[model samples]
Target: MLLISRENRELLRIIEEQKPSSLKELEAATGRKRSNLYRTLSTMAQYGIVDLVRSNKRVKPVVKATSFQVEFGLDEPSQHEKRRS
Candidate 1:
């Protein structure tokens, strides 16, 4: 999933610092539209970057991951090839 972006990073920061109780509160804190925040947070939730908790009939966003590590090697054999061998 494409999770690294300026807007997403900012949203993470806000969630970490403000700790808003619900999406509406987050919308106010970030001055972003509710629809936009919902879409973005939904995507983040799917990627396990954040958690959407339902409390008191409100959806709250919680940051589950604070950092990321990416590793790739071109010299490594493909998984399909290794399995065949």
Candidate 2:
């Protein structure tokens, strides 16, 4: 199973629902700093769950996945759990 953190999920929700045109707008919507949001969004990009589009000097975050599912796992903890430990 692959699980996203609660905060990341909220970020995705804002991106999908609000469709902010730039990171600045997203920051305003989420009440998070641009620097921290950029780091978090960058990580989500690595998972192909979000796309960061750059135009001129602005970066826009687009949500690629709105929902996620679980697959059977042997014994290993999910990435989300591992991060907690």
Candidate 3:
């Protein structure tokens, strides 16, 4: 199961509520340092959960999903389950 940390959830909320146009704006909205926000946003971007658009010298974070659902033990075989012969 994938886990969305509390901090990441807050970041998503900030993006959805404020719709910041740049990293600086997001920093202001979230009260987080730009450098830290950049790193976290970068990681989120890689996971396709967030989009970081680069224009001129600014990177804007866009929220793709305000919330997510996780399913556990659905895709994986249980320990007691055995391979089919």
Candidate 4:
């Protein structure tokens, strides 16, 4: 079944909180260390769930969810997914 992982949830949370903001500020606010936050950001970026805004001395990435209410479950696959299954 398609699903979001725990790290994905945490990443989404961080983005929601830091959104329209920056990761350095997010680290301060969320108490997540830079390393951990960066790793999550990179993974989320790969999934197209987040986007990088700019890269420089500091990276300012933004989050973009597939939907405001994306499904995060472990149920049987949908018809489309079942085909792949």
lDDT values, one for every candidate: 0.90, 0.88, 0.84, 0.69
Model 4 per-residue lDDT at 6: 64
User: Runs in model 3 with CA error above 4 Å?
Assistant: 1-3, 72-85
Please give, for residues 1-85, the per-residue lDDT of candidate 1 as tens digits.
3567887899999999999999999999999998888889899888899999998889999999999887899999999999999
State in Å the error of residue 37, model 2: 0.6
Candidate 1: TM-score? 0.77
Candidate 2's C-alpha runs over 4 A off are 1-3, 70-72, 75-85
Question: Which candidate do you rate higher for TM-score, 2 or 4?
Answer: 2
User: Of the candidates shown, which would achieve the greatest lDDT relative to the real structure?
Assistant: 1
Per-residue CA lDDT of model 3 for 4-85, tens digit only, reads 7887787888898889999999988888999989888888788788999999999999988676776677777766675552
Our tally of clashes for model 3 stands at 0
If scored against the real structure, what TM-score would every candidate get? 0.77, 0.77, 0.75, 0.58
Cα lDDT of model 1 overall? 0.90
- Candidate 1 displacement at residue 16 in angstroms: 0.4
Q: Which residue pairs show collisions in model 4?
A: none
The local distance difference test score of model 3 is: 0.84
Candidate 3, residue 82: CA error in Å?
17
Error of 2 at 83 (Å): 21
Would you list the rank order by lDDT, best first?
Answer: 1, 2, 3, 4
